[model samples]
Target: MYKVIFRIKGNQGNSFKELRQAGFIPIYFRKNGKDEYYVTLFRGKDLGEVKEAILDLSYYLSKNGKYGDFNFATIYEVGNSNLGKIAGGTLGALIGYYAGGIAGLILGTLGGIFLGELADIEMGEKLVGVLGWPMSISR
Candidate 1:
C-alpha cells in the first residue's frame, strides 16, 4: 500500500469523488484556514496510478475552468507511524509542565496524547493546522 499527500487550490469536490471511484481511499480532506485551498491524503496501492488520476483530474478541471487552477503543491510518500502522537504528547507535557508544574504536566500529557492519537487517525490534521502540510496518512 502507498500513501499520497497533495494539496489543490480549490474544493475540487467532484474531482475527489473521481479519485474515490478510482480506488484511492481518502484519509484526510481539510480546508486550509479560511481559504478555498485544501490539503488531502489518499491511500492506494500504486503510486503511479494515483499520480495519473490526480493529473488527469487536474487537467480536466483546469480545462473546464471548474475550479480555477489545479495545481499540486507537492506529491510525496510518507510512512505510517505513531511518532506524531508521541511527539504531541511530549510537547504537550513540556508545555503543560511549564505552565502548571506537576498538575499541569499530568493534564498536558493526557491532552497531548489525545491530540496525538487524533493526529494519527486523521493523518496530519493537527500538523496541517500548524505547518500547512499533511505529514502522514493512516489506515
Candidate 2:
C-alpha cells in the first residue's frame, strides 16, 4: 500500500471525517501559506496499476477541488510498507479480538466498563485505519 499526502481547499461543504469515511484520508496541516491534506489509497504494486491509480486520482482530485472552487494540492509519496502473510493474520486477529471484546462489553460489560471503553477506542482506531484516515498529529 502507498501512503500519500495531499490537501483539499475551499470545501465548506465537506469535512475531513466525512471525506475519510467516503474513502479518502485527510492528513492536512497548515504550512507556509497553504493548507494541505494527505490520503492513502491501496493499489497493486505493478506499474500499470500505479499509473491507472494516478490518472484516477488526478481526475478525482481535480473534481473534488472544483467542488470547492479551489485547487487542491497534489499527492506526495510519504512511505510504503509491505503486507506479508503475517500482516494479514495479525490484522485480522487484532480487529476480531477488539471487535469481540467491544461486543461483549456492550452486551454485558465483559471485563468492566473500563475495558469496554478501551475496546471501543481500539475499535475506533482500527476503523480509522481501515477507512484510511491519514496519520498526522494535526488531526
Candidate 3:
C-alpha cells in the first residue's frame, strides 16, 4: 500500500492529454515557460513504478525543453500510516458515546479523525535516505 504526489514540468502535447485521459490524474498548469504538471500518484499505485515513470519523464523533459522543464520543482510524498483516522474515530466514538452520549460522540469523533489524519503521515526514508533525494524548505 503506497501513494505519492508530484509535480513535473514538461511540454504540452497529446502524451500528457492521453495520460490524464487514461486516469493518470495529471493537472496541467498553463505557463509561459515550459509546461508544469501537478500530479498525484493515484490510489492503488505502486511507488516503485511511479518513481521509475517520473525518472523516465524527467529524461524526456530534459531532451525536449519545449515540452518540459518549465519549472523544476518536484514535490512528492511517499508512504502512509495505516493506523489512521478510521481507527482513531472508531475508538473515540465508542468511548465518547458510552461516557457522554451524543455530545461526547460528536466531539470525540471529530478530534479522533483530526488526530488520525495527522498521525497517518509517513515519510519516504528509502527515497531520501538511500536514493539521496533532497527534501528541503530553504529556497
Candidate No. with top TM-score: 1
- Per-candidate TM-score against the hidden true structure: 0.39, 0.33, 0.35
Better of 1 and 3 by lDDT: 1
TM-score: model 3 vs. ground truth: 0.35
Model 1: how far residue 58 lies from native, Å: 2.3
Residues 2-118, candidate 3, lDDT per residue (tens digit)? 333334444445345434433445433444454444533334355565545545444444444423332343434545665678988998898889989999999889888877765
Task: Mark the regions of model 1 whose C-alpha exceeds 4 Å error after superposition.
Answer: 1-35, 59-64, 67-70, 86-114, 117-139
Ranking by lDDT: 1, 3, 2
Ten-residue stretch with the least lDDT total in model 3: 130-139
Which stretches in model 2 have alpha-carbon errors above 4 Å?
15-36, 67-139
Using lDDT, give the best candidate's number.
Answer: 1
Better of 2 and 3 by TM-score: 3
Give the alpha carbon lDDT tens digit for every residue of 1-139 in model 1.
Answer: 3444544444434455544654555555666532344344556555666556565555554543333223343454545668877998999999999999999999999999878865775573322111222222110
Q: Which segments of candidate 3 are over 4 A away from where they belong? A: 1-3, 8-39, 42-48, 55-66, 70-77, 91-119, 122-139
Candidate 2 at residue 46, lDDT?
45
